[model samples]
Target chain A: MSRALLEVHGISVVFGGLRAVDDVSFEIHDREILGLLGPNGAGKTTCFNAISGVYPPTLGDILLDGARTNGAPPHGMARLGVGRTFQIVRPFSGLSVRENVIVALGGPRYRGNLLRSLTSWRKKGIADEAGAILDRVGLLDVADRTSGQLPIGSLRRVEIARALALSPRLLLLDESFSGLRSTEIAQIEELIRSIREDGVSVLLIEHNMKVAMGLSDRVVVLDHGRKLAEGKPSEVASNQAVIEAYLGRGERGNVA
Target chain B: MDYFATVATLIVIQAIAACGLNVIVGYAGQISLGHAAFFGIGAYASAMLTTKAGLTFWQALPAALLITMLLGFLLGLPSLRVREDFLAITTIGINFIVEAVFIYTPFFGGALGIGGIPRVVVMGGRLGNNQFLALCLVFLVLSLALCRQFARAWAGLACFAVREDETAASSMGISPVRAKLSAFVLGTGMAGLAGTLYAHYARFISAGDFGFPVSISIMSMVVLGGMGTLFGPLLGAMIIGILPEIFRPLIDYRMFIYSVLLLLMIRFQPGGLLGDSSLVVGLLKSLKKLVKPKNIANPREIGGDGDV
Candidate 1:
């Protein structure tokens, strides 16, 4: 495997008295798809939040390409090539889908510059580039549609497309497959594979086991804010600790 | 014709100010109830500079804008931490404090206000009211064009994104502070410019002219006009500014009627006059249905209108 693109070492997140994520560590290599799997309240989203800089870790280090970035703001993280999607999709609802992508495209580079923002219209090929990105995510048809009116499936694609606009090295998707139908999941799974092929590493928090296991190169399981197991999909899925935590003690014996 | 020109002048001035406030409150989603304070600052700054500092009207205009923008940046600093309701309260406090200073401080002429301000001297001659009205119209045109450029630019997009969701905006690499500050500066600066014009045109000013009520009226113009739309504030200013002349008999109940109108607007049409979801659209749709039931029944016709 290539040198780690993202490394979370001994990270812990505490909210009030509760330790939402405790002493979690993981590595995501270049051009890799790593699945972060856990049941509800198992710290999956919390871990994604910490890595994406939404919630800074209370303990340990987050290294992106070997630079320590524990408490960098989310925009700073984006500049460092970290992109994320919300669990509940956040589309700039008032804007057109294309405008939403354009905002993300210009964000890390052109923010706070009145002159650049003004001349951004004449910038060569921005619209075409935004259009190409929308096409890649299969949202070209709805490029001009108001983002607020888009259905959940299209909104999910918009979120991913917006993330892709960052040209991120590491994409943290919080439940990208959640609430998606099996057919839609298959389509997004294909898109994720294509993204990996394009050299973007992905760290996905997924609840859909079939899609997660099928798509991930490797898997890490979290149980009650702690790492339960980690390995290849088959190995991690067969781990007794993971089965017990996910299936409960009474139903553990029936795990496939 | 004279009366018409005077009313047009007021509308144009109010529209310029409303456009400025629209950036802060309408686009950036920051509530500022004290915009009139910046307007006063411009007026007073121009008055003080022209009379006290011995500068020309044109020179004082830019100077007043610069001063107001500096003040806006200072005001925007506290906004980096506070948001929404708290920010609104802070601005209201600023308005009251500035008004108090203008009313009580002898330097600002206390209740008597500033007077003897010279008329706008255009091309080495004092401009008549009509010519002055033309100047305001030119400024209004320029401001509207600048605002349109802003709305079409990435800066405006960033503001909209921040207003919608700060966290999402940040994740996309847009800084909320920078976006909000830009909006605040631009908005307040425009208000200051309007104040400069108001001072030179009115040729007499008092703190009463730019008190809390003026701020409320300005905000109402933006709200009633359409918060983020390019023509919304202009439309709103015209309606608010002219309504008084049209209903001169009930002039005493003017503010009361406006308050009730605002209440109705918020309850039924929060988007305001030119907002996408404005009551005007609803009324148009109903009127369309009344005119041509066939068009109302045809989804394709609705789609065609949307395309347009």
Candidate 2:
């Protein structure tokens, strides 16, 4: 196989004495969807944070498209086409919905000449660009509304939309379907699938098994910060160790 | 007429200075109570350069801006480590330090301050009040235009993003430090520019002119006029800078009234007069209703009130 779009190799994150993410390894290829599944305290979010550069891994390397990106800051991750959503959605509350997306779009454009960036008044195109992203996320109707006024469902979509505005080659979605209704989750599933169809790789951290099993091309299970299993969704879901780890080696309780 | 013109000139100068404070306080969401220190730096720099070094007004203006901006950058470096309440206290300390340096140091004429700041002359003729007011207005318009341009620029958006949330801004590839420092350099430089204009226009200066109270007043302009709005600071400068003079008979109660107005503004309308609050929209809607002919109503709007 060709090179993976994102590679996590022997990554371990230590918070004081406790290893938050212990020797986790994974590889996500181009246009692929990899579901990261674990119960609470499984270190899924920790792994995501390490990968997205909120905090660096204590050991091992993160490779984005064959380039070593270990220890890069969040802004550096963004510049390298790695976009992510917060698990606990952080929208720019003071800004309008469209302005949120526009601010995200400003990420790469910040590299422009200082004087040119200041004096150039050709902001004529940025609104249209933000509008287009909002349209894709079905937020175009409420584009003028303040982001803080939106319901949780719409705010989740706005978070995704803002991440997409980065024009990322790889998108890291942290609990995108959490706190969403069934219908909202279904819509987000479709959106995630469509994002993958658009040639953007997805690394999804999900507690919901149905969406994870149905949507991810591959699944990696984490148990106490260790990689419990990794394979095709069906294979990993049926693995005896995975089943035991999830259901405590008792009756075959429903995963969902 | 001369008195009115002088007040107008002072308002214009304060408006320019207020715009600088607005960028740090409003757009970048940073606290700066020592803004008048930058203004003092500019005024002192221009005054000394003109009187001691014999540089012309134009030459001294740029030098003053550069010197003040450098100081602003240096001062901004330490503030970056702290935020909000701590930052405010740090700026207050800076204001006191600048005041003491001017008062105790004889290089800047001690407490008396440098005098005889040469008048801005064109074609070898001293400018009259009208001409000088016209000059200040030109600079005011240029400064306002610069601010408007910065607000719409990518850099400005980054500042806004940083102001909203630093982590989120960084995730979107904006360096919060760079955005904040840029705000300080630009905003403080503008304050310095305003100082240069004030020195030349007033034809005299003293350390007492730019002190802690002046910094508070400048901040009050940004807060009262509406932080974050383009024209809010200018509107604030007019209200706080000139309105008090209008009620000069109640000079003892000026600060008290300002305190009441600001308190009411913060309590009822945190966004300021023209801030991003819906109060302005509601007020405008009411004004529009008051102005329009009540008989001529749109058919589609009969049952549909546009209130959100």
Candidate 3:
């Protein structure tokens, strides 16, 4: 595999008295699809929050392309080519759907001077690029619609479009298809495949093992804030520790 | 030439001012109780230039705008991560500081206030401020149109997104701070421009002229008119502006009557005059079934308006 695009080493987050993520480490390669699997409260989302800079990690080193960016703000991360989507799909409700993608693409983080002379020209270019990305994900139809008015499925896709606009080497999608329908999930899975095809490494945190297995190149299992297992989809699926944690093994079930 | 022209012109000016405030307070979901401070800044910027620096009212207006925009951008820094009561307090504090500067500063005319401010003239025709008032209307229209366009643009989208959810917005690569800052700056600059126009036309200025009452009035116009809609600010300003004028005959009881009216309006009509266009659309769609009765029943069934 190529040199690690994202190297998260010895990351830990302490909240009050609880060690939310204790000594977590992982690597994602260029053009790779890394699946993160863990039960509710298993620290999957918290780890995502740390990597995406939503809340900085209390401890550890996060190197994106060999540059340490542990505690930098999320916009700083975006400027450094780290793009992300929220698990809850928080879109700007007052803005049109296309505008959401445009905002992501044509933000101050990447765009030129605020009072540039040829802003219209730049805006047109940005709009074209944003439109193409949205069209790729079949979200062009809702381009002019206000984001708050979109259904759940469209909002998830809008989040993906926004992330893609960043043109990031590392993209993290937090349960991108959590509340999506069967067809919507399949559409997103295909989009994920296309994103990987574009040489963007994606770390997807998903509860849907079936979808994760279908879309992810490799799976890493976490249980109770610890790395339970990691391997190819089938291998990770067959792992005893994962099965015990997810399905509650014979003695464990009886104990419960 | 006539009082009708003056009042109508001022209404248009205030309406434009309210529209500017709407972008920040309405669409951006920020509560700026210090909007008038910006107005005061604009007035002073223009008054200082036109009276002391020997610049034309037109020239000083833009100058005032540029300075006010810089100050607004600086002030918006606190809103980067602050929320709720803290945000409100910081903004109110900014108002007080700016107001204090105007009140205590000798050049701001201190207690006596700035007078003999020149009437603005353009093209040497000497229509003076009435003509400049026309120009202000033009600026107002331009601002409103631009704001409406932005309301439909990614900039507007960024504002609403941050307002609705900050964390999720940041995750989507939308910087909430940047969006909110832009909104705040745009809103304040427009307010300042309005104040400058008022100063130039009225030929007088005072720190007390732009204070809490003005800020409250601007905010109420936005809320009572409708928070996010383009037309809401102007509509709200017109109603609030005229209501006070009409209640002038009530003499000593005018303010009391105004307060009761405002209270009743707030208590009964929080959504203002224009609430939800979509909800209204839905209601109309349901009502339309009684007429057409054809097999068309989904409002979101279409792709979208596509107006941009």
Candidate 4:
């Protein structure tokens, strides 16, 4: 893949009188972890949604590996190696741990459909690949159990596993750390390092400033659907606009 | 004795049919009210092949399966974009369209219906009613096992995840629309199997038999059984399938009691019987039983109650 796996340029989304995300442009370099940060309603999610194809921009383009993938659906993007995890982890609750990954691992890129896949099993090493994916997710232990029975933290990891099984070039994590205990958050942080270390470009949106600041190679801050600051975490953390956005006009110094 | 055996067999057959419906309604949380249409398609496919081709019943069975599967896949097209009430409307519409086709088409015998359906014979000779019933029971067991497997398998889990949260499931690379449609097609295909069996066993078929009431009855079975459990559909089908017959002495009042029972079941147990029995619930219940309760309640554990 190219060094810049995804180049999201000039993207904009408007809601009546409000601009949810305006002229947001960012490049996700290959094998790097970038963080998007904003307070509640900062258009961080709207921007993520646009990139993920949940919301096609009211304006502008997104290039996946230098090809315009602007209006592609999630399935198409997934097929092209763009995988994502939800802020609220969605493990097909009724499904066992393995099937969650199986769909992504068995998409058009892998097993495809029923008839073709029936033959794929006999071809060579397909079962081993599926087993490998389950093992990678740490879900191999609960591979037989219903994913729904899991607590929120484990479901979050399942979401990551299912995404990873897609064999993505770019992984977008939406609040991957939200709602987890510190120990659970630590496990995810470690997993994120390993995943980024494996050459997948990651765009993570997080409200937990410490986690975002700690892990991000670079952090971008937004306010009222507009980019307020984008730079190294230390620099963005100290920026006047970002400080104002987080702490309001006169309280910027107090925030530190 | 014959009546008992037949009821038992019919209960198993309908239970299998209801199990398919339950996959869509119960596990995936989509309501499919036109399931009878799939059943009808299967029945017609089997009937046509046996009569027109002079094929043995066994030979016709697979043809019936394939045709109904095609019908199911086609009927499933509308579900690719809709769910809940809209999906129900589409299925209901398909049922009526298929029913109209059945009642009017010269090929399907119009209102005169089709007959002379050769009895299903498993071992070269015509199966006695009891022997035929055993085969149906075997199919029922296979169907039930298939349902349970899918319900708990990745396919079933995707349905539940989508049912619980569409956005989250999609983010995990599972398109909700695609997952639901697959479930709908598979569920309808099973309904076709049920219809094929019914046609051969009954030796005659009519459009009027596979109508809206039957669809409602199937939905009633899934809801009555519990929306997302292995035993729910079976239990739901048996109760709905046999209760009216049991109360036949009440004449027209049999249906009235059945309706009241359905209403009470929904109100008292919204998730159906097996709905509340989640793993967490089972574990917690067991844990609670093992511990003695103390009277002191902590007020500080409240979360977000004060937020307006």
TM-score of each: 0.94, 0.92, 0.86, 0.82
Error of 3 at B5 (Å): 2.7
Better of 1 and 2 by DockQ: 1
What are the per-residue Cα lDDT tens digits for candidate 2 across A160-219? 998999999999999999899999998889999899889999999998999999999999
**Candidate 1 chain A minimal-lDDT segment of 10 residues:** A118-127
lDDT of 1 by residue, B209-298 (tens): 998999999999999988888998999999999999999999999989999999999887788887977767789989998887663466
Worst 10 residues of 3 chain B by lDDT: B273-282
Q: What tens digits encode model 1's per-residue C-alpha lDDT throughout A11-68? A: 9999999999999999999999999999899999999888888879999899999999
Which candidate, 2 or 3, has the higher TM-score? 2
Which candidate ranks first by TM-score, i.e. highest? 1
In terms of DockQ, the best-performing candidate is: 1
Candidate 2 collision pairs:
none
B1-308, model 4: which lDDT tens digit per residue? 78877787777778878888887787778878888888888888898889878888889888888888887777777665785688778878888898999999988999988989888876779987788788888888888777766754455555666887777667656678877876777788788788888888788888987887788888888888788777888888888778877777876786677688789877877777667754445677778877957535656544436763
Supply candidate 2's per-residue lDDT for A151: 93
lDDT for residue A155 in candidate 2, whole number 0-100: 94
Error of 4 at B38 (Å): 1.4
> For each candidate, what is the lDDT?
0.90, 0.89, 0.80, 0.79
* Best-first order by TM-score: 1, 2, 3, 4
The per-residue C-alpha lDDT of model 3 at residue A167 equals 86
Instruction: Point out the worst 10-residue segment of candidate 2 chain A by lDDT.
Output: A247-256
TM-score between candidate 4 and the true structure: 0.82
